[model samples]
Target: MYQKKVKESNKNNIFKYIFEKRKSFVINDIAENLNITFPTVKKIINSFLKQNIIFERQKVGFGVGRKAMEYELNEEFCYSIGILASSTKLKFILTNAIGKILKQQIYELKSNNCKAEILNSTKDFLNTISPEVRKKLIGIGISVPGIVSEEGNFIEFSSKEKIVLSFIEELKNLFHIPVLIENESNLAAIAEAFLTRNSIYSTFTILTINEYVGISNFHQDSLNNTLFFKAGRLHHMVIESNGKLCECGTHGCWGTYVSDKVLLNDFQKYFPSIKTYNEIFDLKYHETNIGASLIDNYLEHLAIGIKNILFFSNPEKLIISGNISIYKEYIADKLIEKIYKNHIFYRGKETIVFSSLNENGSIIGAAMFPILDKII
Candidate 1:
């Protein structure tokens, strides 16, 4: 009985140590790190390997002793699905426990018939993945353009009766898996926060500049805290009482002045022939004249809205994502400069960071949501 209890104690300690590292550790490293004997560590690891609870990989070193091996938590045993929906398109991606993408698909969408199109797209994307893989899916995480409650409820008002009525509810019934819905900007903020090495921001704002700008503030107790989602319609925040008309039925709304739509409009006025943003981005000569100056102005306009958010949230970090995040160095400096100019009392040196998770961060964040939730 004493020997059995001792073995159990050692096993528990090994498990605790692995989680504390938050990253993979080799056998010798784990043993030394935990102050446990090598033989004991080897036995525990071998048991875990046989049970397929952990994965092992070969490691090489020049230190002469037979190069030790490395081990990490196996992800293939679990699965998750992430869906990112926007006015222009929808991205569906599959991932495993280690946050590796197994497969993904992007679909062009029409805003007019969004509900049916979104549902069909979801089904089609899921169908593409093998049925055997689908059986292992534990949950689905969705990133939508508008606000969502803490429990993954869609609170933002919509037009389609099917969606505005009970689309999320129907999906839950169909899938019979945990479905988590979140604001797109909220996902972007978390992705950018994880990418930052400076600090884990519990309170921060994320600005995503697509055709229209979407903003959201994230407030949480810790890195593992539940995310608070608040709608930040900077585009609808009035800049001038009698300025340009906005799509949200408000005159002089910020969106009329500081959205990607405005940039596209500017491009049309000058070039008259340009059809799409991709075309504008692809132009070579635009690097000197139109592209550079337009991007500069867009940055200036974006700062005005960010300044407003700062006044309220006083967030320690501001993350910028989506297509606009590509020109981060240029835009970030511009936003910081304008914020300093507009708010003299803002002495707090909040770190402004860019998303290193690529343009598809929302999808990855969504995919990781389920896996991390289970592991934690």
Candidate 2:
């Protein structure tokens, strides 16, 4: 029985490795990369081919002898649904086994909507998924801007909505598949890390600056080692001893000065018609006095928070993610310059970079949860 379990585990690992590659891989390559025996890998590959989980691809010539056959995941074999719930919108993504997003949808939710209304809309959305995709779905992963209880029963959403346990239960009943809920920032970090599979850094932190500021730490080999630093409540972390009052009944929280809402509020005072961050950047490019000043202040506050995070954890890399990352080219250099100027200790450290996953990081990472859970 123990030997059978080990073989099954090995097969699952091989499948996960192929899915991550997202391309054809030779049997020897899989064995070499995963450190599994060639015979074991070949056995698994043959089994997957028979099960239609993977298919043989065109042979690739390698030096001499007959060409080697490559195997690639059958992407449509399984599917996952990822849902990201934020203060303003609920975003959905359907992905195949290898994490390729097949479809996406977004729904705006009123802040005042009751729990029942929210659930009803979510159910309706689920019902609309393509029957073909729904047929192969193995699970659903939800990324919320808040924490979920260990039992997966309760959610403490950032919007402070009364998202009851019954809501999760309803989703389970509706989908009839395993459901997992996790913090949005954590999911984003996972997605970013997965995409950067060759990155040398084993420990990194992801800071998502959107309507809210969220932070999540990650350790590549051992996710359990990643610390939970009360990411959503970062807004309550006092940056100023006697600063302006925050919604969390705090004074001068870092989030108060470094969020999308704050940036928009400050920019509108200068040009009342400017509605988006892109517009703010447009004014900054033209060097408007208010735009320059607003950007400078935003960068300074961002620097302070980043400096603190660096000193506190000093991870190998710090990834800046979210809608704000779209403007990274404009802000990254200035933010780094400010950080070095204020905290010279990190002047030469390769600690910060914008997230490559962009806004899709959380959704992709959430989708990967069901797949990762089975293999990892």
Candidate 3:
């Protein structure tokens, strides 16, 4: 039993270590970094090659002797479906074994029957996948803006639905496959970090500033770690003692301050015709006195929430994601300045940047979850 456990542990570690490491790593290099014997690592590599789980790339010359073979995860080995649902948006993506996106469709959530839209979109996604790909289809991953149960399956409450658990359960019965669900923010952070993690930062806190708010932390090997899907609840954390009232019937919740809805609502008071964030990002708006003041106030409030995130978790890098990422270029300097503008004695110096993945993080993460689950 002990020997079997150790062997299994080594196999899992090798898989995760390679997935996190830079692409095209040689066998000897992996053995050295993982502190395993060369023969043992080579044997494991042979097993992976036989299973077609990983494949060898071009050999690299070692300057003196036999050329070493480079290897990488075989992306074509399997596929997963990722679904991201929010109050105002819906997205579906097909990804390979390692989370490389293959096909995608996005839609605006304007209809009254939210669950029906999700159901139809899911059915469409499954129907469109080729029969060859269906053979490799392992499971489906779901990300949503709501409080998910600790088991990572039940969605207790969402803005539009009272109990989404039944709908999710029905999906399992209809499809007859394993399904995993998680809070959108948590999955977004995972998706972003999975693609972008590097040696400079092992930890990242992702803040999704959409019509609603969501936050989660990710590490290079975040998939191996267990996470409680409570990030959805963090949106309701009160930042002010008695500030603006939130729709949840609370005062000073962070959502009431930095959320896209609050910002758009405040913008509407000055420009009633503005329906979406696209109109608000125009530089000409920043030229006006009222517009400048509104942005400044919004930036300050956003800073407050970021500072709160820093104080509690202190991740090496804080990423700004979700709908706000669409306009990061316009507000990057101002957002950073406001975050560092005040509280010299209190705020910690943290590297903050906008995710290059933009708004696709949740869907990618959602798809990546089930694929990674297979490896573990």
lDDT of 1 by residue, 93-160 (tens): 88875456888888988655766776788788878878888887878888776665434434452212
Per-residue accuracy of model 3 over 128-210 as CA lDDT, tens digit each: 89999988888999887776764443574365465546676788888887787777777776676556642245556778877
Which sections of candidate 1 miss by over 4 Å?
A: 1-53, 57-70, 75-77, 98-102, 110-113, 149-166, 194-199, 220-231, 282-285, 288-292, 342-345, 348-350
Worst 10 contiguous positions by lDDT, candidate 2: 1-10
Model 2 misplaced stretches (Cα beyond 4 Å): 1-8, 62-66, 111-114, 151-153, 162-166, 197-200, 222-232, 283-286, 342-349
Clashing pairs in 2: none
Worst 10 residues of 3 by lDDT: 1-10
Q: Can you write out model 2's per-residue Cα lDDT over 1-376, one digit (the tens) per residue? A: 0001212367766875886786778999989987999999988899888878888976866587778888877888888888887777788888887668887888787655645444666677668887877778888888877766555556767645546556666777765887877777777776765666424466678888776788887654433323222344465567898987887777898889998889888988868888876677774442776677888998999988888888887767888888778877877888888988746464354678887777777888889877766554
Best lDDT goes to which candidate?
A: 3
Order of quality (TM-score): 2, 3, 1
lDDT of 2 at 87: 75
Off by over 4 Å in 3: 1-8, 57-66, 107-115, 151-154, 157-160, 164-167, 198-203, 217-232, 239-245, 268-275, 313-316, 342-347
Cα shift from native, residue 313, model 3 (Å)? 4.4
Question: lDDT values of the candidates?
Answer: 0.66, 0.74, 0.75
